[model samples]
Target: MNANVSIQSYGLVAEFDTPGDAMRAASSIRDAGFRKWDVHTPFPVHGLDAAMGIKNSPVGWFTFFGGCTGYTTGMLMIWFMNGFDYKIVVGGKPLFSPFYAFPVCYELTILFAAFATLIGMCFLNRLPRLYHPLLKNRRFAAVTHDKFFVVIETADPKYSPVETRKLLETAGSRHIELIEE
Candidate 1:
């Protein structure tokens, strides 16, 4: 690596003393039409999602589809074997009935639903990320403990260094710093 390599700015991070401050800052950032920004806090904050203008998650849809697939697959498999492929008659009972397949269908529905939820969450979050510039910032480490933070990425079209800094300042940030990549 070259010693004189120039570091690129990742974004601006503002630290707030309380979740309310961070939520307010997030609302302001959201209202400003910034597309790339986030707020971090030690724990979940009530109404913060609304403040950030976040909509409902689509993960539930994935789970629903997966469950439907699983149930359909179970029913079809049972029907193919019992009703179509090789018929078995015992005690004058029907070849296939939904009551008999209910156990397998129910189990598969739960299994596939759980798998889909995990996969959807990972896909939506873009997980398995090995690194992020924010992880290197010492000040940001407080986010996991006591502090709340709002980060506005430089990639956002609405981001202006001076204006963003001023916005954070006005939003009641106790400290603000530029992150580098």
Candidate 2:
């Protein structure tokens, strides 16, 4: 069957009328073992993550480590600059004062964590998508309005347009489209 697939197409998109249906479809897809499927909705849907079998995002770990590194760097910089580099013993105060360096270390920790979080989010989500084949589907526009959708990528090992379409339909999807890459 010449499905007329495209290189840009992530996969097939199936539109459901309601969040309930979409959630059900997502759960079904998850259970069916499609690893690269995603559900799109106008707003975040409760329990959708569980339905998708997604675990807690790893961004938190990135932030935590980034913060730690930042804190260490900040502390080290303060210590080295004041104690060793310049050796400015001002007002008879010790050069490596932990109390004086606390704020900078705290700020640097937050700053690095923030940057890492942004970078991690971008990397994890594959941001700057620029364009998606689903955008070509006029019906997909409703996804941002009141519609919900589930997209199963063709790159999935189990992807079969015919079978996937049937699965979506069975899961209560109404408008199923073969999105090109």
Candidate 3:
């Protein structure tokens, strides 16, 4: 993964052997006005979301949009197909009555909402990324094995590599390194 090396852009990365330290660092970093940051750990840590200031995701908005699209499409399909193309009046009911198409519309809404939730997450997070600059950091392998890491991206406006290192150092971080892009 190291072969395709980019320019050495620097950022602060703090490594901890415990989740507690990682969470503390996350909170402190967030309080310090560092928005471009991420936390990684071997296992899910309780209260980590609060520490990182992560709020409810916007995925619900995606699902809502999908539901709306599905409802409109389903209604249009039923209107055009059943009412205009091939009208059928069963039990002396109105041919284009919306009540008859309610079930199909509801089903399509749920189906599209579910699909949107799944696809929205993947899209927002930019998943299926086979490579990341951080993957080149040898010490990062322990992130999936009982270690915790917090990285502040260099793109952050307040990101001065030296200042970030000092901040992390004061926040009880043990080992810190500069991640190169």
Candidate 4:
């Protein structure tokens, strides 16, 4: 296996011709007690997540954290810069008035959350990764078209190329191939 192309170190990939077959294969793979696998499709397929046993993404938590940071920073900035440091006496209002700072705080909260969501998603997913070992397998191009693919990472304790391929075949995958990472 070439180091540049193999991202997972070892894995078995099974390709399906139709989304229905792919979904069925996913369910079968889950029922077979295998974990550490992923499914790729050309487009969104209903019930695919449930079949793969994937839970909701954790990106929301990251966005929340970003919002919190933004809100706090915005409030502090207004308070120190306008209220305390400059001591603006507009309309005879008291310093550190929450009413005047509400808009800035609200805007900052939204800005930070959006920024965090984008950056967090990229970081968590290891984005900017231009090279993937899976590319070495020319057959994987079908994933962008009408094909569906399921890859079981070799890192899983239960994974073996031969056994995995056989399982995929039994599960009705049309084609099975070894993907080196």
By TM-score, the best candidate is 1
Tens-digit per-residue lDDT, 1-181, candidate 1: 9979887899999999988888888888888888899998999999999999999999999899989988998999999999889998867888999999889999999888889989999999999789999999998998899999899999989999999999999999979999998
- Over 4 Å off in model 2, which ranges? 1-9
Which pairs of residues collide in model 1?
none
What is the TM-score of each predicted model, taking all chains together?
0.92, 0.91, 0.89, 0.90
Candidate 3, run of 10 with poorest lDDT = 4-13
TM-score, cand. 3 vs. native: 0.89
C-alpha displacement of 81 in model 4, angstroms? 0.8
lDDT of 2 by residue, 1-181 (tens): 6678535657888888889999889889999999988899999999999999999999998899999999999999999899888888788888898889999999999999999999989988899689778888899999899999899998999998789889999998778888776
Candidate 4 local lDDT, 70-156, one digit each (tens): 999988999999877888677887888788888998999999999999999999899989987777888998789778889888888
Which consecutive 10 residues in model 2 have the weakest lDDT in total?
1-10
C-alpha-based local distance difference test score of model 3? 0.88
Answer with 2 or 4, whichever has the higher lDDT: 2
**On TM-score, who's better, 2 or 4?**
2
Stretches off by above 4 angstroms in model 1 are: 3-6
Q: Sorted on TM-score, highest at the top, how do the candidates line up?
A: 1, 2, 4, 3
Evaluated at residue 112, the lDDT of candidate 4 is 97
Residue ranges of candidate 4 with Cα displaced over 4 Å = 1-9
How many clashing pairs in candidate 3?
0
